[model samples]
Target: MSLTRRKFLSWLGAATVSTTLGQAAQAASNKHFSGYPQSHGVLFDNTRCIGCRKCEEGCNQVNELPGPDRPFNDLAVLDKPRRTTAKAYTVVNRYENDGMLQGPVFRKIQCNHCLEPACASACFVRAFTKTATGAVIYDPSVCVGCRYCMIACPFEIPAYEYDQALVPRIMKCTLCYPRIVKGLLPGCVEACPTEALTFGRRRDLLRTARERISQFPERYIDHIYGENEMGGTSWLYLSGVPYREVGMREDLGITPAPQLTAGALSAVPMVVGLWPVLLTGVYAITQRKEKIVKAEQEQAVAAAREQARAEAQAQLAQALAKAAQEKEAAIAREVKKALEEAAKVPTEQAAAAPPADTAQTPTEEES
Candidate 1:
C-alpha cells in the first residue's frame, strides 16, 4: 500500500512512453511525395536579352497578373534589380558592367524549373508538379501551408501569398503551358522583337546555344548557366559576362536536390516505425533495473535499522545483568555485616553481668 520511490519513477517512465508514442504517431501520419517522371522543361537565353522589359509586359498581359505601381512600359524600374512576385511571374533586372559604357545588361528572372526540382521534391502534400512540358505547375487544393518547398527551392522562385487572408497559394511561372499545348509560342517569346527570349524544345535550345558559342566565341560565356547546375534546370541561361555578375548562384553543385535527402527521408519511416518497440523494450529494461536498485536500497536500510536495534538490545541486556549482579553482591555484604554486629552485642552483655553481681554484694555488706 505504500507509495514507494520506485513506483513513482515507474509512473514517470510510463508518462514518457505515452508522450513519445503520441509524437511518433503524429510523425507517421505526416505526408510525403516522390515526383512524376517524363516532365518537360524550358531554356532561357539571357545573352540575347536587351533589358527592354518587354517580357515583363508579355507576362502581365498573358497571365492577367495584377498591374504594378509603375506601368510595364515604364523603363525606370529596370534600373534596379527586381525579383518575381505573386502579381508578376517574371521580372527583368538590369546589371551594368563596372567601368564599361556598354548598355546595361538585362536578365529575366523566373522559376528555373529544375530537372530535379527541389520544390517538387520538398512538397509533402504534392501541391507542385514538374510536368512533361518542362513547366512546374502548382495546385492550391492540396497545399497545407507548410512552406517546405520555399526553403527547398535553390533559386527562391516560389513566392507565397502571405497577404491573402484565405486560400493563399504558391505562385511562379507556368511557362504558358496552355498556349504551348495549343502549339503556339509563349507570350514572352512572341512579344520579344529581338529574339531575346527563345522558346523551343530544351534539346534544340542546347544545340542553338552551342552553335552560338562556337560561332562567336568572344561574345558569350563558355558555360550554359542551368545545363548542369542543381542537376540541370529546364530554364537555362546564356550570359554575355559571367553568370555571377547577373546575380545567378554558381556554387550549387550538380547533384539533384532530392538525392541529397533520399538517404534520410528513406530512413525516417524505418526509424519511426521501430522507435516504439525499441523504446518500450528499453523502458522495460530500465524499469527492471530501477526495481532492482530500489530493492537493494530498501534491504540495506532494513539491515542497518535491524543491526542498530540488535546492538541497542544487547547493550540493554548487558546493563540489566550487570546491575542485578551488583545488587546481589551488595545484599550479601549487608547480611554479613548485620550478623557480625549481632554476635559482638551478645558478648558485651555477657561481660557486664559479673560486675553487676559484685556491685550488689558490696551494697548489702555496707548496710
Candidate 2:
C-alpha cells in the first residue's frame, strides 16, 4: 500500500503495540517440545525404588565428580530434600507419604534432558546443546560464565563450580553421553539392583510406562511425569501417589520453555522498532515550528526596513522644497531694488535737461 508519513507512523505504532502485546502473551502458552526422533531415554519407577543410594555411587564413579562431604551409603542424608550440585550430578530423595501409598517414596533427581531446554535457549554463546541421543551437554570452553542458564532452568539443574575460580564450569547430568556412544548403559541405570531405573528409547520407554500403568492400575497414579511435561524429557517418572509428593513439579505445564520465553525478549525489539516513527514525528514537528518562526522574523525585519526607507525619502523631499523657496525669495528682493534705482535715474535726468536747454539757446544765437 502507498503509505504517507502520517499513515506510516500510524501503522508503525499499531504494529509495535501489537507485537509487544502478542509476544508478552505467547511467553505463557502451553506447548510440547519434541526432540530428536531417535533420542534415548530412561524411566524411573518410583514405586520400586528402595532408596538404596546405589545410583549416587554409580554416578560418582562414572563422572569422577568431587567427593561429597558425606559418604554415598549414608541414608540419613535423605532426611531433607537435596538437589543436584556441582560435585554431584544426581541425588535420591525420600518422601514419607503418611500411609497414602504402599510405602515411602524414593526419587532420583537429575537433569531431565528436555527436548527444548530452557538452559540451551537462555545461553547467548551456545554453550548448551540438546544432543540427538537425548543428552543436554554443556561446553565450558565457549561458556562466558554469565550464569543466565542457572536462572532459566525450570528443573533447577545446571549447577556451577563456584570454587573453580580460574575456570568455572557448569555441571549437570549428560545422560551418559560418552558411555551411551560406546554402547554401554549409564552407570546409574546399570547399578540399580531392583531395576527401578529402566533404560530404552524415549518412545519405547513411554510405551513401557503405559503398559505398566495399564497392567497394574492400582499400583500407579496413571500419570507419567515426564512423558508430556515441558514437551517431554529423556528422564521419565512413574509414581505410586501424586508426582508432587516425590519432589516432581506438577505445576510445570506440558509447554516447552523456549517457546514461552520468546515473547519476553520481544520487548527488546519493540524498543528498537518503535523509535524510528516516534523520533521522526518529533523531529518533523520541531523543524516545522522553527521554519514558521524564522519566516515570521524575516517578514517583520523586512517591513521595518521598508518603513525606514520611505521615511528617509520623505524627509529628503521636504528639505529640497524648503531650500528652493528660500532661493526664490532672495532673487525677488534683488529685482525690486534694481527696478527702484532705474526709476530714480530717469527722473533725475529729466530735471537736468531743462538747465541744458536754457544754456543751448544762448549758443544757438552765436551760431
Candidate 3:
C-alpha cells in the first residue's frame, strides 16, 4: 500500500498519544507514590478556630495578594461560604451545627496537597509537581493553560486567573513551601491566635490528631478527614461535627487518583493501534479494487481494438474479391465483342461476292 504523507502523520499522532497514555497508566499503577518521607504537613482543628479571619489577612500579606472588598476584621464574610480563588488561597467558611451547643463550625478551605495529586497526574506537560516538602506546586512556565487540573482535583482547590487575559495561571495554596523550608511557620498557621492550625511532620500531626480524638472522644469525631482519603493528604483535619457538615467530602475512597483513571486510559493503546491498521487495510482494499477496475478497462479496450482490426481486414478482403470479379467480367465481355465483330466481317464479305461467285467463280476457282 502507498503511504501518503497525511496518512503517516495521522498514524504517528495517534500512536504517540496512545502509547503515552498507556505507558503513563501502566507506570502509575506499578509505582506507589505516598509522597516523600518525613514531609511536613498541617493539621486543622475545627474546635479551636474562632472565625477571626486573621489567617486570611496573614495569607494575603505573605502572598502579596490584592485586598478584599471586605476587610479581614469583618466576620460577616464567613456567613457566605467561599472556596479558594486566585485572590484568596484559603477561606474560612461557617457552617451551622444543628442541635449542638457548639454553635457554628468554621472550616478553613485550601488545597489538601494529596500524596498522589491528581493535578500532577493529569498534567501531561509536567507543570505540576509534588515536591519532597509535601507541597503540590505548579510551574507556570510549562503550563499549557489546560484547566485539566481543575477537573482532576477532588478538593476543587485549583483556580484559574481568568482576569489575567494576557497570561492566565492556575492558583492554589502552595502549603507555604517557601516559608516552611526556611524554618518558618506558614503565615496562616503563624497568625492563628487559637493555635488551631498546627504545622509539623505528617506522621506527627497524624499522631496528634489521633491523641486528640482518643483523649476527648466526645469532643471530636473518631475519623481524620485526610488520613486515607484519596490515598492520604499532607493536610489533615479534625472536626467536632460531621465532616459533611463543613463541605468536606467523605466519599473519596482510599484509591489514588492516578489508579482511578488508569483503567480507562490503559485501553487507549490497543484501540488506537488497531484503528490505523484497519484504515490501512481498508485503503489497500480500495487500491486493489481500483487496480482490478483498471485491468478490466484495459482488457475491454484491447478486445474492442482487436475486433475493429478484424472487421477492417474482412472489409478489405471483400473489396479486393469484388474488384477481381468485376475485372474478369469486363475481360470476358471484350472477348465476346471481338469474336462477334470478326464473324460479322466474314459473312459480309461472302454476301458481297455471292451472285458472281455462284456463276462465274465455278469456272475461275475450278481452273
Candidate 4:
C-alpha cells in the first residue's frame, strides 16, 4: 500500500510528538539526585554524652590535624563554646539549659553531611564530594577560594583558612570516610566510650534513633535532629532539651539549601547568555534609528539649500532683466538726443548759408 505524502508527514509528526512527550515525562519523573543508598552514618545521643573531648582528640589523631593550643586532656577547653575550624574538624560544646532537669548538656558539632550536600552543589569547580560512605569531603586542589560552599551550607560547617597566604582551602568534617571504607568506625565514634556516637547504616540509624526516642520519652526530645532537617543528614542528633536551646537551628525546613538557589542559578545561564545578544540588538536598532533620522535631516537640509539657491537664482535673473531694460531705455534716449542734435545742426547750417534764389541771382549778375 502506497501512503500519501501528507499522511506520511502526519505520521512522522505524531511520532516526533510522542518521542518529545516521552522525554519530557522521563525528565520530570527522574528529578535529579538520589542520595547514596545504604550509606554509613552516625547518631549522636546527647543524653549519654559526658562532655569529654575524646572525639576531638581522636579526629586530630586520625586526620593528622595540627596540635591544638590547649592539650586534649585539658578539660578546661570546654569552658568556652567553640565552633569547628581548620585545625579542629569537630568540637564538643556545653550548653546550660536552665529549664531542663539536666544542668548542662554537651552537643558535638561537625559537618552534617546533608543528603543534597550544599557544599557539593554550591561548588562550580567540583571541589566537594559526597561519597557513598556518607562523607562530604573537600578537595583543596580544585578549590579557587570562592567561599560559596561556606555560604551555601545551612549549618555553616565549612571554614576558610584566612591566615594562609596562598593555597587556602575550605575545611570541614570528612565523616571518617577513609576508615569507613576500611570497615572501621569514624574517629569520634570509635573514641566515644559511652556509646553516645553510634556508627551504622543511615537507614538503621534512623530506626535506632526512633527506638531511643520511643524507649525514653521523658529523657529525649520528640523529634530527632537531622532526621528530616535540610532534607535529612547522615549525622543524626538526639537532644534532652529543645534543639534551639543548645544553639542548633530547628527552623531550617526539610528543603535542602541547594534547592533554594537551584531555580535562580538555572535562570542565570539564560540571563547571562542572552545579555550580549540583547544589548547588540538594542545598539543596532538605535544605530538604525539614528541613521534614518540623519538621512531625513540631510534630505530636509538639502531641500532647504536647493530652495534657497533657486530663490537666489530667480532674484539674480530679475535683477539682470531690470538692468538690461534700464540700459536699453538709456540707449534709446541717447539715440533720440543725437538725432535731434544732428537735425538742429543741419538746420543751422542751412540758415547760415545763402538762399537758393539769392545765390542764383548773384551768379546771373556776375555772368
Candidate 5:
C-alpha cells in the first residue's frame, strides 16, 4: 500500500503524542531493566504438557473471550499448528519431537509479556502498559487501532478483532492481570493438572527453570527460553528438544524489543516537531502565489480601465477644442458682416445728402 504524506505525518504525530504522554515511563525503560521486583510470571515445562488444551479453555473462560468454533474438549484441533487468535488468547500446539520416545510434545502459545515489551514501545497511543505485576496489559479505550504492537512483538502474540468493524481491538493474553492482582492464580495455571504450567515471581520462576534443567540434563535442554530472550519475558520455557523443533524462533536475540526498535522510533519526535512548520511554510508559499496572481489580475484590470478612461478623456478634449474653434470662426464671421454694414451706411447717407443741398436753400428762404 502507498503511504500517503498525511497518513505518515499522522502516525508520526501520534508517536510523538505517545512519547509525550509516556515520557516518564519511556525514560525508565531506556536504562538496563532486570524485570520488576517481585513481579509474577509463568513457566511452562514442555516435557510435562499432555496437549490437553485445558490452559486454552481456562484462558478463554477467565478472559471471557468468544467461544471457539471447535470446543476446547476436542483434541482434533491439536492436529494443526495454530497461533493465538482474537477469540483465543492462548492455544496449545503439538510438535512431533523425534528426540523423544513419547512421540510428540505440546507447546502452549501466548503473550510472553516481555520485560521491555515492544508493544508498549511501538504503540503511538500508549495503549499497552508493562505493569509492575509483570503483565503487559492493554487499554482498548486509548487504542487508536494502529496495530504496531502486533508487528513489534517478538512472539507475534497480539491479535486483531476483525469481526468487530466499528471498534476492533488488539487482543492478547493479559497474564490474567486481574486475577494476579486479586491474589488468585491465573486460570490456566490453576487448570493444568499435570503441573505443566507454573506461576510465581519472575525471579523464582527462573530459579525453578534452572533447577529443572540441572536436575534432568538428559531429559531437557540446558537453556531456559525467555530467560534473556527479548530482554527476559514473564513467561519462560523449558523444552526437552530444541525450541525450533516446536515452531518457536530461537534467533530472537537477548536484546529488548524497545531497544531493537529505538533507532527508527527515535526519529518520530523530530518529525513531529518539524511537520507543522513545514506544512505552514508550504501554505504560506501557496497563499503568496495566489496573492501574486490575484494582484496581477487586479493590476491588469486597473490598467485596462485607466487606458479606457484616458481614451475617453482625450476624445472629450478633442471635441471641446473643435467646439471652441467653431465658436471663434462664427464670431469672426459676425465681425466681418458688421464692418461691411457700417461701411455701407456712409454711402447711403452720402446719397441722401445730395438732395439735402437742394432743400437747404429753400428752407433758408422760408425761415
Candidate 6:
C-alpha cells in the first residue's frame, strides 16, 4: 500500500524519533522520557548458538529476501565476520572461542529494538518506530532516504538498499512485527535448534536471564546486555565471554538515546528550514564585498598607473632640457674657437704682405 506524501513525511519524522519530537525537545530542554511500560523482547544466549545458519534460513524465508550467493547449508561462509544486510534481516556470526570449548562462539545479530532507539532520535521523518510489542518497525513508504536511522543506531542494525535504484528501503529485523502480531514467534527464534533465542515480554525475559545466569554462572557473564544499555533494548544477550568479544557493543550507557539527542533533533527544523535563507544572505553579502574590493583595487591601480606616467613624462622632459642646454654650450665654444683661428690666419697674411701694401697698414692710419 502506498502512503500519501504528507502522511509519509509525518510518520517518517515521527518514526525517526523514539518519542515525539516536541516531547523530546521539551524534555531535553527541561526533563526526559523513560521507556514504555510494557513491550515484548528476545533474550539470546551466545553459548547456545551453534552457528548452523538455521536462523538465517528461517529469516530469509519469512522475509522473502533474495537468495544469498552461497546456500544456507554452507558453513564455509562463517569463516569470515558478517553483518546484517538488506537481503538478510539477521545474521549469525562465529567468533573464536574465549575458552568456551564447545566450539567457536556464535552470536545471532539483528536489530536490538531499543526502548529509546538512537535511529528514532536521529530521524525527523519517522521512518523507524518502537512498537508496543517491543518491535522496532519501519515504514519505508514514509522514508525519504535520509539514512539518519542507520547513522544513529548504536547497535549498527539498520542497512540501506543501495542496489534498488528506484525504491530503496531501510532494511533491518522488525522483530517479525507481522508474525508476532499473529501470535507466532519470529522465524529465526522459532527455527533455533538449541533455543538460543527466547522470545517473551521484556520483564519476564529479564527475570529468566537472571535465573539462567545464577544457575549457570560459569557458562554466562553476570551482566545482561540490553537490560540497561541505551535505556534498555528489547533484544537481550547473555554471553559466555565479554560482550565485546562476541561482537556486541558495550560502550552504550543506561540513558535513552532520544534524551541525549532531543536537544539536537529539536533544532533540525530550525536549521534545515533556516539554513538556505541564511546561507543565501551570507553569499550575497560576500559577493557584494568582493565586488566592492575589486572595484577599489582597480581604481587604485588606475591611479597608480596615471601617477607613474606623469612622473616618467616629467623625468623625460627634464633630461631633454638638460641635453639641449649642453648642446647649445658646445656649439658656442666651437664658434669662438673658429673665430680665433680665422683671426690668426689674417694676422699672418697681413704680416707677410706688410711690405707690399704699406699704405693700408693700421700704423700708417694711426700716424
Q: Rank the candidates by TM-score, best first.
A: 2, 4, 3, 1, 5, 6
- For residues 1-367, could you state the per-residue lDDT of candidate 4 as single tens digits? 2357456556655655543341212222347454588887899999899988999999999999999989988988888989999899999998887875556899899998888787887788878888888888889888999898888888878988989999788988899888889998899999987999999999898899999999999989999899889888999999899999888998899876667765664554455455646876898899999999999999999999999999999999999999999999999989999999989997878868867755688789889
Better of 3 and 4 by lDDT: 3
Q: What is the alpha-carbon lDDT for the whole of candidate 1?
A: 0.77
Instruction: Give the Cα lDDT of each candidate.
Output: 0.77, 0.86, 0.88, 0.84, 0.88, 0.84
* TM-score, model 1 to reference: 0.69
CA displacement after TM-score superposition, residue 110 of candidate 3 (Å): 0.8
Q: After superposition, how far is residue 21 of candidate 1 from its true place, in Å?
A: 21
Q: How many clashes show up in model 3?
A: 0
Candidates in order: C-alpha RMSD to true structure: 9.1, 11.3, 8.5, 11.5, 12.3, 11.3
Give the per-residue lDDT of model 3 (tens digit) for 240-317. 998998899888889889888787776666666667789879988999999999999999999999999999999998
Over 91-193, each residue of candidate 1 has an lDDT whose tens digit, in order, gives 8888888633366677888888776688987887778777877777888899987889989988888888989878888888888878887887777778887
Residue pairs in candidate 1 whose N, alpha carbon or C atoms collide under 3 angstroms: 39-132, 40-132, 40-133, 40-134, 41-134
Write model 6 residue lDDT over 1-367, tens digit each, in one string: 2357456556645655544345535543545444566789999988788889999999999999999879999999998989989998998888886475666888889999998888876777877788888898998888888888888888888999998888999999999999999999999999999999999998889999999999999888899998899988898889899888888878887878777765776676665545656876898899999999999999999999999999999999998998898888888878888888889898888878776576557878788
Between candidates 4 and 6, which one is better according to TM-score? 4
The backbone clash count of each candidate, in order, is: 5, 3, 0, 0, 0, 10
| Candidate 2 local distance difference test against the native | 0.86
Model 2 vs. true fold: TM: 0.75
Per TM-score, the best of the predicted structures is 2
Worst 10 residues of 4 by lDDT: 19-28
For candidate 5, what is the total of clashing residue pairs?
0
**Looking at model 6, how many pairs of residues clash?**
10
Q: Give the residue spans of candidate 5 off by over 4 A.
A: 1-30, 267-367
Off by over 4 Å in 2: 1-33, 266-281, 307-367
